[model samples]
Target: MRIALGERASGGSARDQVYLALREAIISAELEPGRRLSENELAELLGVSRTPVREALVRLRDERLVAIVPQLGTFVTLISTEGVADAAFVREALECAAIRLAAQRAGEDALAELQANLAAQDRAQAAGDAEAFDGLDEALHRSLCELSGHEIAWDLSRRANGHLDRVRRLSLPEPGYLGEMVAEHRQVVAAVAAGDPDRAEEALRHHLRMVLSGLGHIRAAHPDFFEEPAD
Candidate 1:
């Protein structure tokens, strides 16, 4: 709830802006799970009216990132393994399919863009800039999806990836994680450059699955962030 609207607060409609801000906060764990939300306070904090805050919460509820109780009020939903699995499935299905097409259709220029992104990722990793690497990581996948001539692949994956993203963000601090990620990225890009659709799919699939590999460790370390098992 202490999230600042900050500089990315412009451009989008009030509701869209609010939705993105709240979603990012929740995914980054800045807002934390199970925290009660006050529409009035959120409106005041984001310098918006309650109408937009209400609308944004509605969107978030649809994403299962928050729950609205009849009289008790809204609260950030605890992370659920089911939610994370659903996200992973959606992202893997879309991106894996897209990478196949990207490998088949990628021209030299398109491959160059991906190479440039990988180089940037390497630089970010070397500099110990996790934030920059995160953005670059997203850009690389987006560029690959775009290369498939299906921008919606990335769009849909992004919308479905909230829970998966939280796990990913938390895994950033694992020793050698950034370097391993960059190396995996290189393998994916190399396959695409070789115009080997099968190889590209294999590499991308492995990379995507690796993101889920640390989930157990993360959940163990931050039990408060996850939902309790149902009785």
Candidate 2:
């Protein structure tokens, strides 16, 4: 399948566009684990020049999504349980603080935006549209961070989700996974809306821990995709 840039393509740098497109595909499992990548093939598939495709591949490799071999072409890296757990820790800590700050701010506009996000999530869950739900899940959390006056924390949190991205994508197909997440998100938002710091913190903590809660079943179901757990 071909990669296409979003609205940012019109004004953004070509290399950046290529990077974002390829990264999204990799993260969303569109490319899948262990898929081989060649700059020439990718350029052809994406219908772009080899230079930008090559540049994008370099960045993806740096992100640990693509591994370069001396003789072999680039391959998608397997998911690391360690990576996911570490990221979850960072995300939980940061988000707990964010929700506390958001509670303090409790601006009407931010609360409205969060409520709107919940409404969209409800529709996605009813439709069982995991991809849509995942996108909105990300947006809702980032919105809380931004509203809490900690946009940089959100950026930092996103960088830590490389392996977690795969787990989230893998879990999306499970029955009621996203729907369960919708309810957790609603709890977090409800706390934010009510301006309750303690409740917001607790809800955000629970929401973040949901990633850990499903690790057992996911690893059992997709052993090939996961790295062996450390002793």
Using all chains and alpha carbons, the TM-scores for the candidates as numbered come to 0.94, 0.92
Error of 1 at 181 (Å): 0.8
Please provide, for model 2 over 1-231, each residue's C-alpha lDDT reduced to its tens digit, 9 standing for 90 to 100: 656675424457889888888888788777777888878878887678999988888887876888989888789887788878888988888878887998889788778888999999999989988878888988998898987888988988877777887788888889988778988998988888888999999988887888788988988998878777779
- Assess each prediction's global lDDT (C-alpha) against the native: 0.90, 0.83
16-124: candidate 1 lDDT, tens digit per residue: 8888888888887888999999999988988889998999899989888999999899999998888999999999999999999999999988988888899999899
Stretches off by above 4 angstroms in model 1 are 6-10
lDDT of 1 at 226: 95
- Return the clash pairs for model 1, or none: none
